[model samples]
Target chain A: MTMKIDCPFAAKILTVFIKEELAKFGFKKGVLGLSGGLDSTVCAFLAARALGPKNVLGLIMPYGTSFGEDVRDAIGAARLLKIRHKTIDVAPMVDAYFKKYPTENRVLRGNKIARERMSILYDFSGREKALILGTSNKTELLIGYGTIHGDLASAINPMGDLYKTQVRQMARYLEVPAKIQKKLPTAGLWTGQTDEGEIGMTYAELDEILFHLVDERESKEELLARGFPRAKIEKIMSKIKSSEFKRQLPPIAKISSRTIGHDFLYPYDWEK
Target chain B: MKIALAQISPHLGNIQRNFELHLQAIEKARREKAGLLVFPELSLTGYLLKDLVETAALDPDKSPMFKEFKALSRDISLVLGFVEEKSQEKGLFYNSAAFLDKGKVLHIHRKVFLPTSGMFDEGRFFAPGRNFRTFSTPHGKMGLLICRDFLHYAAGYLLFAGGSEIIIVASAAPGRGLAGKNGFATSRMWELMGEAISRFSSAFVIYCNRAGLEDGIVFAGGSFIFNPFGKRLVQAPYFKNDFLVQEVDPAEIRRARKNWPFKRDDKPEVILEALKRIVHDYED
Candidate 1:
């Protein structure tokens, strides 16, 4: 089953929300890693809309194993958004560390590539004076599907609240390139690697279950009664409960009266 | 009804920028699970826009800015101040407050008692509103009073008579007088009135005011929410922009009214006939 969203309504709020949040922090320009995937495409379009096309810069940092069509689609998205974009092949940077200290595990190598791409993106942020906009959707963030300090490291993320399915819906509303929107979801970690093939379930199924469990706060029995299979329910619940650490700030042992992340909470624009 | 009061500074004559500010506040409120959000007077356009009124006048149903607002109201209700253009008439506008919910305009209150004295020259730019009535919302019956109108006790009386259980005040009041230990004199006075109204009418009061400088006038930022018993549930900081989300129970209205019996003993028809006879028989 497919999901539905009030596209125009959601788009208006999100664009303005992004624009105002950035302005409150005194930022006029934005930079982000755009991989031509649905998540990054949606983020790029929203960033362009918020800061204007000229103020937004898209950085396409592709690994050596990244599909050629994916890189082409990233270029197409940049043209469509009319934002200044650059293609920086991260193959050399990622390969440098791996060649010096070889790793046999495919997942370890993939994590290295992801973190290297993030490192390069940060360098550009300092050089260009732009905030790094994150592209990880709620689905990936909840399940720890992406590298921790890699794709998840962002100054601000407009897509953090949206589930993967909603990201696709937003892409359609933003009139993203049809080819990119229609393509299979991927992390581009390996050749022909798809997101659905990786996480062992479709985003539609995962998000629907999560919507009920997280948003609705449904009990396990209630979810099973709602026709969610027990195995799938247990699997998703385990993932949600296990990845709690990744989603949270590094916990500080209670030694002081008020610690940084514990009691001393303030808005991000506290000084402003 | 869970409510959020957004004490924001709006750019003068820049409806697009101001509209985005309103959206940002609304979206934040919705995330905090607030059912209703309120903004200060002329939130989409800052106050003291004497000549720029024509450019800022929005036909509630026509303006693209308002269209976006309606779309947002599908999930949460909002109260905001804007220049309302009468559809049938040109060049006639009112300093209006709107109650928007579920993609529809639930009610609108045109500021009736336009303050023309002292620093307030609202009557110079806006036509006076004639009637005060309460309208129904998804939460309950509600009324709207903008800025100076909230000060007039008669406004609350009329709203209570019209069955309003929640009174929303949206203001762009300038912060004035010596600062009290807690807040400004203007804000303290408003809080006193809010408490009095809550106890007298047995209704909740949601007050929203703007922050930041508009021209030379510094709009006060002491936005607050009071329960039916006049207890200050939440308050934003003074002289700076702030947003607060607080939970309010609609059930409290019934409990407070049951204890007070004010609405039950109220006489709307007698007051109406007496006022009518006074106007007809007496010379002012």
Candidate 2:
């Protein structure tokens, strides 16, 4: 299945979306964490175009286990856009906390690193008087591959709706650094940690199944008939089901008639 | 006569702010010497009003806000969308569009189709309108269809049967489906419908869609005008606030109607009879 999008059209619309949405909330500047991965690099390109290079800031937050090449690529992306950037080694803060509470689990340590980066991003956001722009694409968001309150937290996200494969298309159109585009997708949480490696499928296969399942609303049986592996379908479906909570606000128990997440419904852009 | 489509963003659930936007647009249209100014669906209250419908609902005849608009209409005719509160019942409301001309409410069209599926929950909030009718304007006989009402072919057909020469649609359609190189898939669908309706009905079709984002739903602001012969007169830019004013000669309506003669050959009695049979069969 060819899940192609008009790259130029998407780029124009996303740029406008970022600019207008930020202005709606009285923000003229934005700051986003740059992982040197395709997602953040694409976001950096869009943010630069939307808010101008001087107004946008990219933060490269990496732990001790992070690759030196990834850090360099992050700086390269920022320089390519001519935007201001800062590299903060998250090892000191993350290590300081884990020193008292030592754990052999890499996932736990990675989650801590993600949260530490978010904390630093917020600090920079306040210091620079800028809103934090999110970089999670539709694939990561749908499959629950992100850490909530960590990478998932941002005032606005222009690339969240675009799937991973679509982001690649956008990157090519935006002329993002070829090295970043060609590099294997990773969270850069620990050494040699790749997204597709952990997910156990290439982005092409995952996005095709996800597009059918989510966007086109194709059933599992229909996907099977269309030559999709049933096991992959089941695995993706289960992941989606399990990660549903990550997509929404915490359920507020209805103790009153007008609950925050229930009856008392207000839009996010509601200035009043 | 010149018709102005105000493709603007309405502040969500903020009547005062949106009303200010309307006044500004009205001033601009008047300065441009437009005979009529049309705003998008819920121009006073914005779309995605889940629980704020009642808060924004107003009785057109009783509200002080309309009085101001009515006074403004004395200078230029206006068409605007708002949640209409039924005077008799306190809670019953309709997604309605009003035509104000010469300081009076000429016609109010409560939206007949309340789309309540897949990212839309209009039926959950408001009552559906029952009739599709046309009202006389100084320029021509015009009909109003709000957003989803324009989607159903029957609404335009009914208005066409009612001797409408101009079909005005106020929409807050969300932008989606980015596979096409031209623009949004949703905007393309609206244009296709507008072309078909204008050609078959032999009436001018003016589509006014809102712009800007509300809770991530971007209202595709590709507002446009189709002449009586299905030729596009003008179109606004997508996803941006724009004011489009075009001079539409009333003579064009007559020429197109005479050339096509679709209305002269139309038979509504046949359609009414067929609808009755279809309804009976479906109920059975």
Candidate 3:
């Protein structure tokens, strides 16, 4: 039983990881933005177990014209868990910005919504002094599907590594509402938008490709030979290569004698 | 309960070796029947790495090193440190601690206080955590404080307010004094910090510090356990890898708090006013 667990699926051990993490940081509760999608729902379930039902707060931030069922499913999951939850209608705030700047694209507006939701989550986190748990999955992180400084922000992330397929499995294990578990994955950025549709590839295929590419370190030609579409493999590889910057901190120039991103390589507790 | 202070000397960029050492410590802890086991700061990746962007990066979900640590969770309730790759966000590296039990990670605490002082540039490598709180576990209400975080009065006060019975300080304290000189200054500072912990929070404190050297900076491994009364219960060997075990009683915390009564008699507003003045002087 004293075997060493690999670090990648460390997020899978959420039951123990979240609790110990919270205790270590002195956090008794957690707040997260619930989008009624697989990622957020799984995060909510994990946070509830980590901090308890009373300690986990779910804030549903819905922009204008959200699918009604998605909101209901999110609320339903919270109710099922008996966790405290609230709804923050972001339609008015998002609409106001769009009205003022009519030329803004929906993508720009969606990014605003994401940032606004994060802002609210952080505000509540401050008031409650609760940690803001993140919900983005590994697939999103690898493919750069998340909005930078928006849905991508959190005090700590528990699901950064579970692929989209793995997230669905975790949702099932956590007994998430079927409505949420079965719903099409979407960022709710616009009407009739689905994650797969936008990405132009199914998660099963994406995960398979990514597993070969990242975990197996397969070459592009090998991935194509392994039944991955040439165009899709190229696209996913491009994302993984390009979004490496997004995965890291802002580059610090070697101005100081010991630069952080460069020379200074101590643990967060180095000064203790 | 026997508590094992697993003062592991981590490799700066070797996840596999560090994780193997962690597993070895857990086995030792179990054999000793220790109820809790603790590891040093960033035990997964060594401190003072040349490029954390490259050295400290870990995909806990996919990294083999993380998987090894997770499997080790079944036997002992272990605490260890590592770097976690955050989501695809700008500036999202995390200094993380994982709580492991029963073959799983019970919880994780990201480092909140990023040091930006001399020879330290954490603010540039990781995002600063904003929340200060406590966590509940089978062990009890516990608080996790990283290095430099215990120096912050607010973090300590918040831990007390959140009901932390035991405060664990996992650190890599820099050793002062020359190669041939005694580390008197570092030891004195650690003693002062222990006294502060006993006076301010009145909780049983366990400090686990890394031993050995990294990037020319020698870690003064002055790890120790402090009673609620500010008494040193056990002190590990300094400047070397060592482990010490001490039994902690919850009732002793109550006794110490009752004896001190600092928690009940303090004026928070007065303390805040003084702290604010130290940071900035505002005109009335």
Error of 3 at B138 (Å): 38
lDDT tens string, model 1, A68-118?
A: 788889889999889999988888877888899988888898888788889
- Local distance difference test, each candidate: 0.84, 0.91, 0.75
- Pick the lDDT winner: 2
lDDT of 2 by residue, A107-201 (tens): 99889988999999999989988999999999999999999889998989898889999999999999998998899998877788899999989
lDDT of model 3 at residue A182? 82
Per-residue lDDT, model 2, residue A38, is 93
lDDT, candidate 3, A74-146, per-residue tens? 8988998888999999988877877888754778878998998999999999999888888888889999998
What is the Cα-based lDDT of residue A214 in candidate 1?
Answer: 75
DockQ of 2: 0.58
Given candidate 1, what's the lDDT at residue B150?
A: 87
The candidates' DockQ values read 0.01, 0.58, 0.04
Query: Tens-digit lDDT track for model 2 on B35-124?
Result: 999999999999888888888999998999999999999979999999999688788889999999999999999998999999898998
Model 3, docking class: incorrect
lDDT of 1 by residue, B235-263 (tens): 88776789988888989999999888999
